[model samples]
Target chain A: MSLDPQIAEKLLSEMRRGAIVLAVLGQLQREHYGYSLRKNLVDRGLHVEEGTLYPLIRRLEKQGLLTSEWREEDKRRKRFYRLSTDGREIYAQLMHDWQLLNTSIQKTTGRSE
Target chain B: MEIVDSYLIEIGQHLPEDSRQDILAELKVTLEEEIGDRAAQAGVEPDVQHAQAVLQRFGHPLKVASEYRPVRYLIGPDLYPAFLHTLRVLLTIAAVGVVVVSLVAAFAEGWQVGVWSLIDVGVSLLFWILVVTTGVFVAIEYSGERLGWYESWQPRRLASGSLGIIDRGDVMTNLVTEGVFLLWWNNVLVLPNVINGDSGSFVFNLGQVWAAYFWPFNVLVGACFVLHLYVLMKGVWQRPSLVLEIACNTALVAVLIVLVTSPEIVVVANETAGDQSEFLTNLVDRTLRISLLVISGFCVWDMWSAWRHFKGASWRRSSAA
Candidate 1:
């Protein structure tokens, strides 16, 4: 059965909100400026709102989970972000926990490999 | 370029002064890159239309600026209960204080003042009180520091003892009634036509005794109102509030004692055909004495209760230590 469009949108939003932090952290493993990072994420089938992504990037940098520096690129200034040491440590732990939870959920739902 | 400048200006208006320039520069660069990328895909040079489209997709200036700004509140959740408690207490005292002042003014001046004028005074008092209370809470919220005194508190500290919880409803009722009595006592509201007996018409007036003690009486009531506000903000019957309460109640009791012992505080001015009778005068004197006694008794009870709470709070602190 097809889901109601509003309900589908709401569900998608809720799902995206939970994973966005993890997804952003994963992408920042390599250095990328704001515009390029957004394009890369969209190419990978995770469409982040520009308003949402910019703030998240700034917050992560503030928390010391990401490090950013402004550099000249194509004759324009661009702030590029990359995962810090703390970010890598946190990402590894979060990924491990997420994998365990996913496996357990799959087993409980009788969809185990 | 004009549209971009205006858009940036709009966003800058919403942003904090410290970070406005830096944030705007970053936003401008990102917008330009997006516009250029879009133009490249459409096989045209970036133009005003492309800039507008990119800015549109980015969202409204307020929405964009809000994302950068931290969430803020006038009174956050942590202080909300205390704020609400303080508001109720202030409103209650204001309601009572205005009424008392109005009644006293009315009686001293005469009962010629209209009801609407008295109501306007009461409303204006309440509005000012609300504004003052909100301003205080906003100041506390922005300070962004939790009260240092409460840092040592833990739920487990009260495990072996029972702390007195304030009943908001009961306190509110008491405050409202006190406010009304204050208005009545002050002569802000006057009973113009209380009785229309067969022999004569009776009007209410302040007795000669009220004029001599009016300032002292008002000062005592005002102190009590301030103490209640302090207690509301503290959200508990702390030592300071309890001590203030005791002092205020003692003053009130002393004043009531003087009023009751003296001959009369309420006078009935009869505007009728017949002369005023001795019996009616005696009755009015007796009623005033009885009312004073009741109020004094309430004050004594309040003092006793405050003393008990003061001791209890001290005991808990000692034991917790």
Candidate 2:
């Protein structure tokens, strides 16, 4: 039987939320403004909504995982963001955990390389 | 630019006051970039339509703003069930109390008057109690989860909140008993005929010990009345409410202990034959002693029951987080 779309969407979003932080953090290793960051992630096949991305950025900043500053770019003011020292350490740990979990899942599903 | 500015303002209005300007500035820059991108892709100016399209893609302003705010939980999932149960229990007690009062009034007046009173009293009492209960739960919710005992045993994990509801029938019995006692205690129901002889000289009267303890009894009985009303609605025993039950029971038992130990709990003032008066005094004293002792025993049992209800409640998660 097919799963209901709403239920399926909810489950999918929960999984996506788990990975969204990693995706955002990985991109934030290089300094990029908010708009450019969104575009860059979208180009890389990770589509995050404008609304969802801002709060995450602010939360990460508040948690001391990101640092941001406003500066003039292309004749207009823009807020650029990048990872702080703590963010780099956290991102590295998370990447290691993800890889291990991914490997286990692959083996369990008989899709191991 | 005007369209984007207006859109940003609209979104900003719904956001938190502290972060409004910072968030709005970021939003504006992002929207401008998005509109510019769309305009370039289609070979057009970054106009109103482009801004509109970008805004639509972002979704509703309120919802977007909401994502940034701390999640609003007046009574979060943790206490929502108990809140609802408490509300239902209180409403039920109010309705029952109203019906009883209205029925008594109806016998004296008319059926229409009784029905009107039932509706009026039921509506007003329910409304006030609902407000009071909701306010209390809201306070508890915002009270920052400081209750060590509340979460000590995984209250939220219990799918069906251990209402520790002994039974609905038992609650009704307690509710009715408390209602009658409150009326009798307040002198709304004169029991002089039952306790006194035809001459009105006291055959059986409460001793001097009760003079100081009147309001204490009212307060304790009222506390238990509310507790039972809550228990009836909850249908299971939870921690904080059960703690209240235990407290009320202990206080009641304490008062009963004092009353039973008193030398003259019920002074028979009849100056008839010495033997008869003495016999009457002994009978009344024995009866009072026995009754209070029995009630004290029940109170102890209630305290034990309240404790046992959640004694086995274990921590479902290692970390509450």
Candidate 3:
């Protein structure tokens, strides 16, 4: 069945919203500032909007899942962020849950490999 | 450079003061970096146009600043439904009050002047109702104190389904009527053509009785307005609102009694009339008395009904417990 363009777009957005948190947490294992982190995500095929990415980073930092610091590099100051201990623990738990769900879905669809 | 500085300044205007400097500093660096990248990709040195393009891509200053700030509202979601309810109630009251006033004026005078007065009063009531209701809600939202009533809400009350939901339409009608009446009482509205005679135009003005207790009259109306708003906000009629309603109704009843008993509660004067003046004055006086009686009846009914609702709520709470 053909999906409406609006419906397809909505579905894509909803799917991306769920995945983006995991993608952000995974990428934040190493230190990267807002702009560069956005670039890394885009290069890895997740084209997160700058507006969306920046706000999410700030929210995560506020939730104590990430720690940020300001440093000067190449004549410019940027706020770099990385996974805190809590964030690392959360990332592991989320990954495990994701794998279990993935396996369940695959088995139900008879697409297990 | 100046364009970037101006852009930062624009964003800074919307941001909260404590974090404005830090957010702007970070945004400035990011925008400049984006401009540089755009310049390299386009094979040209970055200029004001490039900076502008980057800022445009970043989005409007308000939108950008809003994302940085925690979500805020003039009337947040928790109170929005109540605000809407209160607004509807007030508007309905204004409409009914305007219709009644128009009919009375039309009966006393000519239909032409009455129709014009109706339109004028209707428009003014609507405008003031909107302004006052919005102002009240904005004040409540900004107060930021989650009122004790909200905090004390019990799940059993919801489950019991016995909570008195104030009739949305009645509440709205009362609020608007009270608001419009307050405006009229305060001399914000003066109807010159409400009463007319063969000799000349006559104006029906509130007599010295109301003028004597002017501040108290305002306080009574103001209290009623606040009580209606509180009920509408709470959604379920709570004990505190009931107490306030009864108090305001009692005050209104007293005021109405004093007004009706007082000599010449409404005075009518014609600019060019001689013998016909007494007839017009008596007519106006009788009309004022009748209006006061009708309002007084409503006040007593309101007080009785509020008392019943308050008692019913308490009984329900006890039963549920």
- Pick by TM-score: which candidate is best? 2
Candidate 2 scores an iRMS of: 0.8
After TM-score superposition, the amount by which residue A23's alpha carbon in candidate 1 deviates from its true location, in angstroms, is 1.4
lDDT, residue B164, model 2: 42
Residue B154 in candidate 2 has what lDDT?
A: 77
Over B214-301, each residue of candidate 3 has an lDDT whose tens digit, in order, gives 7897778878876786666556776677788899899889888988888877766444556677777787789879998999999999
* Residue B193 of model 1, lDDT score: 41
Q: What's the best-to-worst order under lDDT?
A: 3, 2, 1
- Is model 1 an incorrect, acceptable, medium or high docking prediction? medium
Which parts of model 3 are misplaced by more than 4 Å? A1-11, A89-113, B1-3, B38-53, B93-113, B118-125, B145-321
State the TM-score, rounded to 2 decimals, of chain A in model 2: 0.96
Where model 2 places Cα greater than 4 Å from the true spot, the runs are A107-110, B92-113, B146-150, B154-321
Question: Residue-wise lDDT of candidate 2 within B267-286, one digit each (tens)?
Answer: 65565434456666777689
Cα lDDT tens digits, model 2, A1-113, are: 88689998899899999799999999999998988888889999989888898888999999999999999999999999999999999999999999999999999999997
Error of 3 at B208 (Å): 40
Q: Cα lDDT of model 1 overall?
A: 0.78
| CA error at residue A10 for candidate 3, angstroms | 4.8
TM-score of each: 0.56, 0.59, 0.51
Q: Sort all candidates by TM-score, best to worst.
A: 2, 1, 3
DockQ of each: 0.66, 0.66, 0.53
lDDT of 1 at B247: 91
Give the count of colliding residue pairs in each prediction: 16, 7, 3
